[model samples]
Target: MPDVLSTWIAQLAAQLGVDPTHVDRTLLLDVARDAAHGVARPAAPLTTFLVGYAAGLRGGGVDAVSSAAAVAQRLAAEQPPKTDDGPSAG
Candidate 1:
């Protein structure tokens, strides 16, 4: 992981009063990748942020994370494939 990302995660974990070991980095990254590929590149971070928010609202825990990730994965799977046609020049 990049130094910046590691630092951010550490800071976020500290602010949330949770152990950094509790954060499932792989699962979160997988969700981000799926969201970006299935939806749009810009959707990755936004989707992950929303998922984390949802998890927090439900009471932060492994279950909350799993539930949020599942929802995100489902939404990504349901997104329509991108098309080759570019936006109108106008």
Candidate 2:
């Protein structure tokens, strides 16, 4: 799975004209996992996208990516778990 994931990331990066070295797959995966488990399953992809966007805005690179992902992971970890009951009307 690691080999396949690495290859896929490389191929996708190449196709997208991005540097494969800029992608820290494990870090990104961890961030996604944290977001999914901490917040909600649907938030995983969106969180990653926002992380990348934030990183890009701050001079994109490994450091930027790491910083953004770290912030996202922290926020995800701090989120309160959702309850099954709907919110009460005001």
Candidate 3:
């Protein structure tokens, strides 16, 4: 499952004319992150579709796992600011 995500990233990178070798954690999320644009969670659906599309494009095999891993790593690092970090009532 995770491997599929990576393969999709590779395929997407190729489609976008980005050098796969140059892709890093930040770069992956940069690619995967589509700002709200007046809507929330835009990147989620697109990324999900791309994962499946990439696999279909490559005949149902994992090829972009590394790129997906990079994206996931970037996502974790770029996680939104915590909203629950405040003095707790005890």
Candidate 4:
């Protein structure tokens, strides 16, 4: 099973049209903020995911998942590289 963070990263990557492996800690936190404000709670992305998950379970729709994933992806893709001349740290 995919870990929650990994899963969220993957989902976010897909949404943002970016690579999952390229998403770093800073970008993750930024996206989490978006989820916090855009979803329900302002602290936990998982809480938002749970809300989405529950809605999906009830309606048999995956829109919420896709939306969350997309948000993650967008956040990752839009991030500026840490260094102007090279890639970021691992």
Top candidate (TM-score): 2
Q: What is the TM-score of each candidate against the true structure?
A: 0.80, 0.85, 0.29, 0.28
lDDT for 29 in candidate 1 is 97
Query: Per-residue error at 36 for model 2, in Å?
Result: 0.3
Span of 10 residues, lowest total lDDT, candidate 3: 31-40
What does candidate 4's lDDT look like per residue over 1-90, in tens digits?
987878988998699675565444454465566555443344346744554455456552345445555556565455445454344454
The lDDT, on a scale of 0 to 1, for candidate 2 is 0.88
lDDT of the structure predicted as candidate 4: 0.55
Per lDDT, what order, best first? 2, 1, 4, 3
- Scanning candidate 2 in windows of ten residues, the lowest lDDT window is 81-90
Question: 1-90 in candidate 1: lDDT tens per residue?
Answer: 559878898998899788887788889999999998888788899999998899999998888998999999999988777665522233
Clashes of each: 0, 0, 5, 6
Candidate 1 residue spans exceeding 4 A from truth: 1-8, 85-90
Off by over 4 Å in 4: 1-61, 84-90
lDDT of each: 0.86, 0.88, 0.50, 0.55
User: Compared to the true structure, candidate 1 yields what TM-score?
Assistant: 0.80
Instruction: Give the clash total for candidate 1.
Output: 0
Better of 2 and 3 by TM-score: 2
User: Candidate 4: minimum summed lDDT over ten consecutive residues — where?
Assistant: 35-44
Compose the digit string of candidate 2's lDDT tens values, residues 1-90.
568888999899999889998798889999999988888788899999999999999999999999999999999888876555422233
